[model samples]
Target: MSRAEANTNSPKRERIKRKKQQQGRKDHVEVCALIPVFLVSRARNLLYSHLMNSR
Candidate 1:
């Protein structure tokens, strides 16, 4: 309601927003890193299955 109250709330909101953005970026980076690992594992599994089936 008051300007002083709004000012105090703004800083806290900004901090929360910044923290959320940082967390989202961190998660995105982790997911990006994991994607290659996941793909590699999936490829290995597929290759193993193919080899076994061919034999």
Candidate 2:
């Protein structure tokens, strides 16, 4: 169901909260893509090292 349909039986506050959450998720995805590839690769290497050490 759409946001409007889902908030049909809810109050204005709940609708506003849901709207903000949806917008935040979209913003996060956009920012994630703009991150530098070098930084991303470094992060991946760090995580891989951690995983290897834990195993």
Candidate 3:
């Protein structure tokens, strides 16, 4: 309610916001990294299946 209390809470709120942003960015990076791996593996599996079917 008071300005001093607001000022104290602002820093804590900012820290929490920053932590959440960092975590979101970290998750985004992990998902981005995994997508290519998943695509490669999926492509490999499809290719293997096609080759087996052709044989």
The local distance difference test score of each candidate is 0.99, 0.88, 0.99
lDDT string, candidate 1, 1-55, tens digits = 6999998999999999999999999999999999999999999999999999999
**TM value for model 2:** 0.44
lDDT of 3 at 47: 100
For candidate 1, give the lDDT.
Answer: 0.99
Worst 10 residues of 1 by lDDT: 1-10
Q: How do all the candidates rank in terms of lDDT, highest first?
A: 3, 1, 2
lDDT of 3 at 29: 100
Span of 10 residues, lowest total lDDT, candidate 3: 1-10
The positional error of residue 28 in candidate 1, measured at the CA in angstroms, is 0.8
TM-score (C-alpha) between model 1 and the true structure: 0.78
Question: Which stretches in model 1 have alpha-carbon errors above 4 Å?
Answer: none
Tell me how far the alpha carbon of residue 10 in candidate 3 is from the true structure, in angstroms, after superposition. 0.7
* lDDT over C-alpha atoms for residue 38 of model 2: 67
Worst 10 residues of 2 by lDDT: 4-13
Each candidate: RMSD:
1.8, 10.9, 1.5
Off by over 4 Å in 3: none
